[model samples]
Target: MSNPKGKTYIVEHLDPELGQWSELEYVAIAKETQVAQGTFLLSSLPEAFNVPPALSQVPAFKPERRGVEELYANDKSRVCLLDPSASSDLGPDDGDKFDAFLFGGILGDDPPRDRTSELRKKGFEGRRLGPKQMTTDTAVRVTRMVVEDKIPLDEISYLDFPELKFNDHESTQMPFRYVKGQDGKPMMPEGMIQLIEKDADKSIDDLF
Candidate 1:
């Protein structure tokens, strides 16, 4: 995406376990190329729920090995390009900035029938529990472009991505707490929390 030095588009995923709060899964800022595209699972949740095997491995773009054009040739690939100057109409809703590109079936093996079945099975807890499915099974390819002036990363102070709310409110809010270090202080990397907070806010704006 093209923009002035200070602004950026923080790409993220709305955590299924944590409602309303969008997790800062990835970050995208302006770069010299002026063009950026990546492949992601379009129907991530459903795929995760139905066939967890497909969703086991984390998806990553090997642009250096394979060009974007060739990588996103099929319906399974979800691609998004961020442009700081373009309109914010790339996502599903008007405010939805993040784009859902391709819809893969899922990531890991199917969940066992019960706790005993789970113990007999193999895989981590996070992988065993399939991701929550979105409202629709169809996955839409998404793109987002914004102006540098509109988003200033430095201005962000807090960020959070809570689980989806099942009540009257659209979403629930959760604190982005940091782990305690040996010194008895919140053990977190410098500027990491701030960056997370900024990204969370950006995702929320897009969700609305």
Candidate 2:
């Protein structure tokens, strides 16, 4: 994919302890979803980007997963870490300074203490995306919006998101509604109920 500013890559630092089947599944989904969103999701492992044959059609779908730390070491000047506690925020014209944006893929509630300290010591400037923590995928998307649209970091507010206006007849609204009835019964659509049941069954099967 062509990143007008330069080649944009998202690096995911996988946790060694997160070797669960479901956790690995989430990693695969995250990688594929980012590829679908026109960004490459790279890893430190050589075999991490071995996507299925169907997804191999897109050049951006294939992630470069070899010696990511070395790449950062080679281009230490361009390294930036998306940490909320950082002193600096990325500016509009800041996209061109680096080819890749790195994000840690820790699903835990708190940031990876050791990795964050290491990145800081290596001269990777911590850049804040928002006041609150964000999911790894959300961080990647927000980074794209900043880099691609050249939006100033300070002007970008999560609380004041872009409003979507649609004509009454345009049918842009979703048909699904999830709520609770007066009797405390679930007021979900039939399709949603089926989906929930299916997922619950799948979870139970996976537990065995």
Candidate 3:
């Protein structure tokens, strides 16, 4: 597989309708989360969105108030337009080479007709996650899942993620997280330990 690495970018093509401001907020949060997890994020906000000064200045946030159509026009290669209406599934062949990901960053029961037409004109390959529509944040997470190459975790491995861990003593409301057992040693699952150890061997793999 061609490593996506730094080549993949998530584009948040903002909807022009003023009412979509709430949807744009959801897109922004998703973008921030992806950025934290090491993905590039771009926001193509129309002037109608009136992107506030605070959001525009955020680190790793790229704002293009111009129409998102121009982005595809400028660079068509490896740009995938995510459309639930599209027939293509984002499988290994399509996801590996894709450099840019475009999602209609609007949240609603129905997609904007004009937006779909505009993206279609740009000739970006359209792919759908499934028959059902998903929220902007969910789409972002899915994008990362496809683009990132990693070993799939088993049920036992899932237990080690910090979010899934719980304090052994329910009576003690610890002020901080304790990943170590009562013996004062790291208490992670064996699978998690193996995954951690593999990091040193895979350091040269460049998927990080």
**What's the TM-score of every candidate structure?**
0.20, 0.56, 0.54
Worst 10-residue lDDT window, candidate 3: 152-161
Residue 88, candidate 1: C-alpha displacement in angstroms: 3.9
Off by over 4 Å in 1: 1-64, 73-79, 93-208
Predictions in order: lDDT: 0.25, 0.48, 0.47
- 2 against 3, candidate with superior TM-score: 2
Model 3 lDDT per residue over 1-208, tens place: 1123443445555545433323344445444544644444545665666654544565445556654555556667667887766776665456566766777654223332334555666677887755444444445545555555422211111111123223353221111122235565433323433333444333211211
Tell me the TM-score of model 3. 0.54
Off by over 4 Å in 3: 1-44, 110-115, 149-208
- Highest-scoring model, TM-score: 2
Q: The CA-based lDDT of model 1 is what?
A: 0.25
Best by lDDT: 2
1-208: candidate 1 lDDT, tens digit per residue: 2123221222222223312211112211112112333333222132232222222332321112232233334521223332222233232232222222221111111221122222112211111101222111111111122221132222322222234343465443433322224565433333434544555545432321
Could you tell me how far off, in angstroms, the CA of residue 71 lies in candidate 2 after the best superposition?
Answer: 1.8
Q: In every candidate, how many clashes are there?
A: 33, 0, 0
In model 3, the Cα lDDT at residue 101 comes to 71
Q: Sort every candidate by TM-score, greatest first.
A: 2, 3, 1
